[model samples]
Target: MPFAQIYMIEGRTEEQKRAVIEKVTAALVEAVGAPKETVRVWIQDVPNTNWGIAGVTAKDLGR
Candidate 1:
């Protein structure tokens, strides 16, 4: 089974989230030869305060 967990800030349209899952599953199916049923992806949404970059929070980075 090719399983993946992706973490990102919450705020994407359902379409965008679906696209991510589809692309990841497709790659796993093609490159790793995993079956469509065996390929899985889980997206974990975190708050902006919990995500940071350059020692700054995502909210701060946006400022």
Candidate 2:
């Protein structure tokens, strides 16, 4: 089995979430030789306030 873990700021649309899973599964099937059914994807969503980059939070990106 192949496993993928994706972490990102929260507030993604349901379609976006589904796309993530589908793409990861396809990659695992093609690259890792894992069956689509055996590919496992785990998504961890963090709040904007909890995610920071270069001393700026995701919420700060809009500014």
lDDT of 1 by residue, 6-26 (tens): 997989889999999999999
Candidate 2: list runs displaced more than 4 Å. none
lDDT string, candidate 2, 1-63, tens digits = 788999988898989999999998998898878878889999999899888889998788852
Residue pairs that clash (backbone atoms under 3 angstroms), model 2: none
Counting clashing residue pairs in each candidate, in order, gives 0, 0
Worst ten in a row by lDDT for model 1: 54-63
Tell me how far the alpha carbon of residue 24 in candidate 2 is from the true structure, in angstroms, after superposition: 0.6
Q: Could you tell me the lDDT of residue 60 within candidate 2?
A: 87
The best candidate in terms of lDDT = 1
Q: Global lDDT of each model?
A: 0.90, 0.88
